[model samples]
Target: MSLAPSGFLNLGAQNLEYRMIGPVPEHAPTIVMLHEGLGSAALWGDFPDRLQAATGAGVFVYSRAGYGASTAVKLPRPLDYMHVEALEVLPKLLEWIDFRRGLLVGHSDGASIAAIYAGGVQDHRVLGLALIAPHFIVEDVSVASIAAIKTAYETTDLRSKLARWHKDIDTAFYGWNGAWLDPKFRNWDISEYLTYIRVPVAILQGVNDEYGTIRQVEIAREECYCPVDVMEIANAGHSPHREAPETTLDAISEFANAVLRDEGFRAA
Candidate 1:
């Protein structure tokens, strides 16, 4: 099925909202973007447009179930929510989008989902990955930051701000927050998946990211036999695409161009 330029994609029991920029997947190499835990398709701001302009590749951004305008999920998401997203949801989404050859560009939880998909699915259509501030394992810093966000959501205007992007604001925020804050989630790990990935990887991390330390990058290097590239963005935090747009765009565009070169993909 040919996807509308921007609309809801009906996948089984849920409808995921998405935006498509540049050429269609069948026309050019696609860059599928997965947003952060608290992020929606709209929360990605203009980064998708900028990425399309920079790389000259089709960019598809989507809101997962329970986020943005997508269907709301049940409260208290499972500890392996990322795994479900990667192993189940993503495969169908790709098939529906007609994703033939492309790179997965994901941020934070989205990045983890991308990594899990790349490692677990073994879909040859996925040529590479551009992961921004991904978490391979839960860390003390990640938990502390999540806990602090919960406080801000309850006491401050954070909820109102996030509500603009998410239709079910509380569901989106708490689903991600609750999972990370759950003590059982401390055992959450996807580092094992890295060993199976056959594509090149580009990891763009913020120098002072509050949610995760450099250890996340270390784990990818130690586990993946595939070529891995790292770029630490200075004066930026966890959301480098938002915090450091130009640098993030340049790095990702360069990587995408290089990996998708065989498909005759180019960068602007």
Candidate 2:
């Protein structure tokens, strides 16, 4: 499928890169995608198109500041950076897009940001969340894997590979890497926000995810009062969307279709 035209969105001091895919009918809801820590709008490849085809919902994706062609940020990002993005940037994005109501498709760090927004923000337009490989709380395995990635970025060809997608590779790498590796970040947890999320949540996780364990899924199920569905795909690692696209797409499509059928949420 051909890609839609791309553009830069100005949100205060930040300029975020965004891409819209599929046909956005006058009344249908849009799927706003949030990339991972090291991911960009380009890195998402054609998954958005596949999603659009599967669910018949317009797909919108954006690269946060410091990633892709968006604005660059300073290194050694704050421990509350994700919170800032969730509370500050996301709201601006929705407004810029003129979002009526839709589902949030977030991955890894992006998922955490989405969760925080769904719970913290009073906007009832957000209908549901499709969280992929989310981390509600810090874990030893997560820290160890992040440390290994830091070593790889410093010694291996990882930086060069990532440079193709990001304008300021260092800002993208260090901004995310440094924050997660900081000792003070160990206490970082968004489980408290789960109690506030009233929409349906579809959690798609990989059984072999190197960064996090099933504890993240357990936390969501235990904390959320909404109907939470979990999909643990085998043989997939960190990114189930990239590793097993068909399964991931099917799960997301099914969930979105169900949401579309809800008469309570009319088309915007």
Candidate 3:
């Protein structure tokens, strides 16, 4: 499916950069994509397009403030930044985009943000959740990996690579990195939110994920009262959507279609 030109949304003090894939048919669902930490709309590449094609849903990909072409944010972001995003920003953003109801497809930090929003807000617009490599609780491996990434940013070409996606590289990187590396952040967990999620959840995690373990999925299964579908991809780590795009896409696409086909289910 062809796409319209990329556009920007002005939300008071901030500008959000976004791209729409396929057409936003009034009768069809819209899949809003929340990118990973240190990732932007562009980093998602053609995944959104493939998803749109596979599920026949409109796809919207956007970069949060301080990433990509969006406005830059202050340093030392609050430890509850993700909470702020899910509770405050996401609702406003969806309203801004005129999102009536659809699936939220989030990766990594984006996934956590999606879960938080679904649990916190009682809005029925959120039909289902497609969380890719999500983190509900902070893990030791997460901290260790983030620390290694910090070293890479300081010594390797990772910063240069990230420059291709972020307009304010430092703001984007440090905002996420600093928040996660903070000692107090170790206690940061959104497991309680999972208990409130009533929508069907599609979780895809890489078996060899370096940043998080299968424990993340385990937490979701244990806490969520709704149906939880999981895909543990082999030979993929941290980012199954990037490392194993086909497998990941197929799983989410199937789930979305199944939910849409069911007449008795409601999105909450």
Most accurate candidate by TM-score:
1
lDDT, candidate 1, 3-38, per-residue tens: 688999989999999999999988888999999999
Residue 248 of candidate 2: its Cα lDDT? 93
What lDDT is reached at residue 191 by model 3?
Answer: 97
Compared to the true structure, candidate 3 yields what TM-score? 0.95
Better of 1 and 3 by lDDT: 1
Residue 208 lDDT in model 3? 94
- The candidate that wins on lDDT is 1
lDDT, residue 265, candidate 2: 36
Can you list the residue pairs that collide in candidate 2? none
Q: Which ten residues in a row have the lowest lDDT in candidate 1?
A: 259-268
Candidate 2 lDDT, tens digit per residue, 153-221?
Answer: 999999999999999999999999999999999999999999999999999999999999999999999
Q: List TM-scores for all candidates, in order.
A: 0.98, 0.95, 0.95
Candidate 3 ranges with C-alpha deviation above 4 Å = 1-4, 25-27, 263-268
Instruction: List the candidate 1 regions with Cα displacement exceeding 4 Å.
Output: none
